[model samples]
Target: MKYIVFFIGLTVVLLFFFSSCSDSNSDHENKTEPGIQHESMKAKTVGIDFAGHDFFQPVSNSISHIHGIGYPNNQEALFIATHHGLKVYSNGIWYETKEHNHDYMGFQATSEGFYSSGHPEEGSTLLNPLGLLKSEDFGKTIEKVSFYGESDFHHMSASYYTPSIYVVNTVPNSKLGTGLYYSLDGGEVWMQSELEGLPQASAHSLATHPRLAKIVGISTPEGLFLSHNNGNTFSLISEERSIGTFFIKDESILYVTADGEESLLEQSLESDDTKQIPLPTLSEGDSILYLAVNPLHEQEISFGTVAGDVWRTEDYGDSWSNILEKGNVP
Candidate 1:
């Protein structure tokens, strides 16, 4: 009976040793072989807002310039332009489109569709011309339409009253004719507006008044231009100061950012007169890259800077608060 028990114990030890050796060999093979199992690449989280605090999230890979950002008219989706392609954030999911070789310039949304434009990319060559794209499903997809050859597009504005109509400004390029183009048929075709009173400088931003369909404002390198004839003609409001980003609350009030100043201007659209309103002070410069006014409250406004700081104003630009701090998001 003792001999039988010893033989069984010896058999069990040999079996255990062989199984351990086999498992070790399998792990070693996976480490050495290219097709064997391996850890997956980590995903990138570029930016995050936690409990109202902004944080910088890093990406494992580099990306192209973020030329533009747009939000849908009726949805919470945000569209970002990256060197890789257009990135859409919707319902907590991020999706990237195939690279189209274009530098996304500007974006606008309407009830009928969404509009965007950029410089075209072909192979290794990049064309500074305007290429318009449209999407009906809140940027779930994009389709190229008319190509304004060689002219660089700097600004775009969608008509609030007429959803199917939009306008874009082209910088003077050697290859492409520089000016503005109006698309009345939802980007299927475009016609140049020969507005006699339009300014000659490049238009950088455009906005239409919410209540007045004929009242529009264009921010150019020279100054601000007003159009009362539905973009058919334009006239300079004030040429003494260079206007950067601008927002129109109504036909009576206009908010504009002036060059070389940290304060924003509250001007009357009726008289083109201005009053400088100081913005919130920051350790970094007070330069603002973009300004957005609350759709419901004209007194509430948000301004973003190149240093990644976002400032909010609640009392009609009289006082401001920094909502986002610099170096908090990358």
Candidate 2:
């Protein structure tokens, strides 16, 4: 009787997992409503959200100048944000979206779609400087948030599941002045953070909690600091010299530093514990520039390098697979 009951329980659990997975994939599709971008009394975007086609062509020379990297809500594939546009990697293959190539900068992926700032392509009806745009269909249908043509945020970090936004503004613009700014109401309103506990050195990079609206991080040449109060203040997390690049995955902050030998470390948010993930020997003059964690599969992580190299590890950094070499498809 015990054995039979155990078997029955296991079967039920497996069924529930499969059912949830099926629902997960369709939820984003059903919830995605087409969006429009309006600027100067003109339609900024008129592209179809889904082309009604499920086909993609293999692409090459699509990985250089990578600004950021991400995975869609479903974690079906990894998307590379580049100066030319967005390229995708899945099942050991690289593909590109036709006619949607735009200079994507400060890209942040979310549970629904993705957010970015950059310039639109030639045929794009949207404003030249994609001040801030949200794609409900992964860059097909874009919705204007703010700063339509005023600013192209180069350093931005936003919540993966919330409307919170934080950016390190390097230039002053109409909607924002140069400094650290954040918005909790989905870009409806904004506020500036005082950066109380951050080191005096220049902030090199930024990261934010995936679900928590207030949790954020900043890395400098001196150290890494995290803020629970939305950048109003911060607490020192690591003093390792940052190369101005890092990312957040769930409850941990993963960062890299150039201390003699380059290294990547994951630090727990709940404690001071830190452990290093194996490093793939990088060529001289190259450093990890961007990172993305598969939300659904935490063990799977990927990163892009300054030299346009990309690598993935499905077993939580135990091993790595080089997907792109110097921005080429091979």
In angstroms, the error of model 2 at 138 is 1.3
TM-score of each: 0.59, 0.82
Global CA lDDT computed for model 2: 0.69
The residue pairs in collision within model 1 are none
The number of clashing residue pairs in each candidate reads 0, 1
lDDT of 2 at 249: 69
lDDT tens digits, residue span 1-330, model 1 = 000000011011111110011110011111221111123223222332212222212223334344444444433334555434454443344445443534555566443445666544455232234345655543333454545333333356665336444444323233223345556555555655555575554344567664565667766556777877666777888754566667666555454545564457777776867787767776645456556554434566665555545566768767876644552322
TM-score quality measure for candidate 2? 0.82
| Residue 108 CA displacement from its true place in model 1, Å | 2.1
Q: Which stretches of candidate 2 lie over 4 Å from their true place?
A: 1-55, 60-62, 123-125
Write candidate 2's Cα lDDT for 1-330 as tens digits. Answer: 000000011011111110011110111111222234332222122222222424346784446778789886455578888877878787777877765677887898877778898777666655556677777666655777777665666678889889888866544566655667899987769888877766555455678999888999877666778889988888888865554467786778888775556788888889879899997777777778788888877888898887789989998889998889899877
Residue 18 of candidate 2: its Cα lDDT?
A: 8
